[model samples]
Target: MRTAYSVETVRAAERALMARLPEGALMQRAAAGLAAACADLLGRVYGSRVVLLVGSGDNGGDALYAGARLARRGAGVTAVLLAPGRAHASGLDALRRAGGRVTGADDAEGPIARADLVMDGIVGIGGKGGLRPDAERLAGLADRSRAAVVAVDLPSGVEADTGEVRGAAVRADLTVTFGTYKPGLLVDPAREYAGIVRLVDIGLELPGEAELEALQHADVAQLLPSPAAESDKYRRGVVGIAAGSARYPGAAVLAVSGALRGGAGAVRYVGPAGDAVIARFPETLVSDAGPAGAGRVQAWVVGPGAGDDAATVAEVLAADVPVLLDADGLRLAERDAVRGRTAPTLMTPHAGEAAALLGVRREEVEGARLAAARELAAAYRATVLLKGSTTLVADDGGGAVRVNATGTPWLATAGSGDVLSGLAGSLLAAGLAARDAGSAAAHLHGLAGRFAADGAPAGAHDVAALIPEAWRDVYH
Candidate 1:
């Protein structure tokens, strides 16, 4: 798992490590790693023109020290001090001793424009908002240059904890972060600004659990279920899906499409559109008696074009099994009933539904997606999947939240969410925890969606047809 730490936690860890080592040791380690990375980018340190945008904090210190190292190795290094008096005194002295020229920002624009490489040291974890006037001007200059840019810690002006960009931020070609990854480096909006991320371990022991994480292939493989040697169809698990109306029988087909492809032993579908589901997937066991009478299912998937049929909704909720709610089910769900469930519940909502649940505007949810997902989970006391450009899955128990980065923008089509809901429900039936099931299903769904439509636009059926290939790739 790739873990991300909050700014306060990173600071504490840095302090603990700093106390154990000699003064300036941590900064030296960071600077050395940074200098080595820059050397690789420049190909040869000698004769390369390097410019540092120095600010007023430890971030500038890291850049200055690294500049001194390059200067000693025959590179033409210059530091443009935005706040000369408040700059790291020791770093400035070291750079001067190593033959690096230091100048104020007023006279540094020409060198900055002509440099081969630029280091953005304008802000770090301690920064509150976007760039100051002087820093903004320098960032604009760097934007127009052909030189490769390296950010010292994080790209300046990004919210370290939430991954939200308050205002204009430096768009780095590469970000060399110290210790651990920040939340902003992994999420969108801010993540788009940070090009390729490289981590340098400066001897800070990180916490065991991170606030957020991006799942790797190994992590997903481990979480997914495989059938035992002696397992029978009845022994594995059964998933029941309640979906579709006469007007939207395709929703039922898509839901069953996901359920059959998901790693479940059998699928029992119950709804008014049973004949439509049977026509599409003849393997499914369909019943017109509704979800409650579907008989012995380990999990239930409700909603997805279920319309306003309160009677059917009640029947689906009556099942004593893990349940996943999506689409119209999300609209008709009573908070008290959802909260009173004995089994685990998962809710998958896009920005519009999440906005309704949180009583906030849709723009607010999109602006700060992480906060919106967490708040929705807490409000409904269920695992919440906030679907969009960057899919976020948040658990109500305050555990690690997951961000799915495998999806494409082409997934914004009809019945796509229904497929996701059924996939998650099937995983739940297979006995994975609610949070793991939701995230794992999303990962597979995204991969399948991409595979079905590699370079072209595909409808819902194409995505469903590619599920088997996705599962094979995961195992292989």
Candidate 2:
């Protein structure tokens, strides 16, 4: 798992580590890493023109020291000091000794525009909000230039902890972050500005608990269900799917397609489109019966293309088993009914559905995805799987939110969420907690989407069909 820590946690860890090390040792370690990464980015350092946008803190010092190293290696380095008086006196002196030229902002733009690489040390993790006017102007110039811009710690002007971009901010081709991964580097909005991120280990021992986590293959392998020799179909666990309407029978077929491949013992489907489901998957036990009349199931998946079937959603929610809600279920189910359930509930909502529930605009939810996921989980007192370019799973218990690090852009097909809903519901039936089920389901779904699409456009059926391959790829 790739875990991210909050700024407060990072600062505490940094202070402890610094106290143990000799004076200036930590900064030198950071500077060495920064210079190495810059040299790689500037393939031909001997002839490359490197420009450093220096600011007023240790961030500026890191840049100045790195500039000195490049100058010694024969790169023509220029330091454009944003705060000349407040700059690190030792670092400035070191740069001058190594033959690096110090120029004011008046002569900076010309060098920046012609440079091959631009290093942004204008702000660090401690900085907040957007860039100041001068910094914003420099950011604009960097954007206009053809140089490959590299940001220090994080891109300037983005909220370090929340991934929020307010006012003007610097966009970087790459970002070299120190010590630990900040929440901003992993989440969206701020994630968008940080083009490609590289973490530099400065040897700070952080907290064991992380604010967020992204599951990898090994973690998912441990969570998958396996049948014992004595286990029968019923013992493995049954997933009940209540989806589709007379208007859209394909939704029922697609949901079943996903559930069948979710390592469940069997699938019990009940809805208006029962015939269509059984026709597609002869293995499915089908009935037009409501959720109450449906046979025993460990978990229930409700409301994909279900239209106005509010009673079905309510009936499924009232059951004493885990329930996965999606599409129309998010709209039709009463808030009281969802909140009142004793059993666990997992809601898979797109930005628009999430917005409707939160009574905010879709843009607001998309802009602050991490905050929106947490707010929704707390509000409904359930686990929320907010699906988008980056899918996040958050539980009401306030544990680490899981971020999915897979999938292709080609996954925005119709009925895609329906497939994901069924897969997650099946995992719930197999006896995983709400958090584990949602996170594991997202991991599998994303991998399946990649295999199904590859490069060409794919339909929901294509993705659902590849679930077995995704499962094998995980374990082996």
TM-score to true structure, per model: 0.94, 0.96
Q: Residues 255-347, candidate 2, lDDT per residue (tens digit)?
A: 888899887899999999988998889999887668888799999999998999998998999999999999999999899899888899999
Tens digits of per-residue lDDT for model 1 on 151-227? 99899988888888888889999999999889888777788888888999888998668978888777888988889
Model 2 residue 276 CA deviation (Å) reads: 1.5
Per the 3 Å backbone cut-off, how many clashing residue pairs does candidate 1 have?
0
lDDT score at residue 50, model 1, on the 0-100 scale: 96
Worst 10 residues of 1 by lDDT: 310-319
